[model samples]
Target: MREAYHDQLDSIFDDLAGICRRVETAVSLATHALMNGDAAVAERVISGDVEIDVAREQVEETAFDLLTLQQPVATDLRTIVAALRMVSELERMGDLSVHVAKVARLRVPDVAVPDEIRPTIERMAAVAEDMVGRVCEVIISRDVEAAIALGRDDEEMDGLRRRSFAELLSDDWTHGVEAAVDVALLGRYYERIADHAVSIANRVIFVVTGHHPAALAEQ
Candidate 1:
């Protein structure tokens, strides 16, 4: 029974890692759809979100069962609790990707990102993708250092979001109000995705050290 419980615990992390990979793919596909105005790809991402949602539910249920049945304590308890939070962050990341795809879908044949802002959006997408990928590694390995480093990536995302806004507000800006709104919202979605990845990383730190990242830094 002990071995079985451990196996179930391992399965929870495994499932979380798999969900991170899927969210990474969703971000990439959504970016492509946004850049190329590919409604089909956008629709693919939107439809596939249900799979992510279902996976999240399964992981959550398993974690809850383990908590209820095994009554994990100390590190094991922290791991289970952190898994719950991490899985939710991953689900939110998936939802953010879906939001990006929805914007692309709404635009249909017309690309949602204009030429001036495309570079910033592209960079945001790349950074968001990289963060999610690193998140998968951190989840599996529980590397506290790597998890903490994700904050730097989050910073870069914030800068890119600011750059996108600068472009929108520039004197030379010619895109209409609708396009501007899309650019602003798209930048926000990507930034929020990165934010969620960082949140999961922080959770990993807490699980391993029994302390939040902020408290560790103060030491």
Candidate 2:
């Protein structure tokens, strides 16, 4: 019975890792759609969000089941509890990706991001993708160092967002208000994706140390 309980914990961990991969893929595909003005890719990303949602529900249900039935303690309990919160962050990240894709789809046959700000959007997407990919590794390996280090990536993403806004407000800005609004929204999505990635990393820290990163930082 003890061995079986451990196996269940392992399964939950694996499923959480899988959810991260799904999020990574969604963000990647959504960004691709944005860059290329590909409505089909955007549509696929919008539809694919259902898979992320399902995976999130599975994680929550499995975690709660483990809590109710097995009486997980110590790190096991931390893992189960953190899994619930972690999946929530992951699901929100997935939703942000869908928003980006929808913007692309809305402007179908024409790129949502004007050329003047395309470079910033492209870089923002790249940073977000890299952070998600690294966070997946952190989750799988339980690498505290990697998880904590994700803050640096978040900082970079923040810088990119500021740059995007600066470009939008520059005197040379040629895109009208509608396009500006689209770019602003897109920047927020990318920034939020990075924010969620950092949130997951903080959860990973909790699973490892049993203390939230914010609390630790306070000390």
Best by lDDT: 1
Model 2 is weakest, by summed lDDT over 10 consecutive residues, at: 210-219
Off by over 4 Å in 2: 215-219
Clash count, candidate 1: 0
Candidate 1 versus the native: TM-score?
0.96
Error of 1 at 31 (Å): 0.5
Per-model root-mean-square deviation over C-alphas? 2.1, 1.9
Which residue pairs in model 2 clash with each other? none
Clashing pairs in 1: none
- After superposing all C-alphas onto the true structure, candidate 2 shows an RMSD in angstroms of 1.9
TM-score against truth, every candidate: 0.96, 0.96
Give the 10-residue window scoring lowest on summed lDDT in candidate 1.
Answer: 210-219
Question: Scored by Cα lDDT, where does model 2 land?
Answer: 0.89
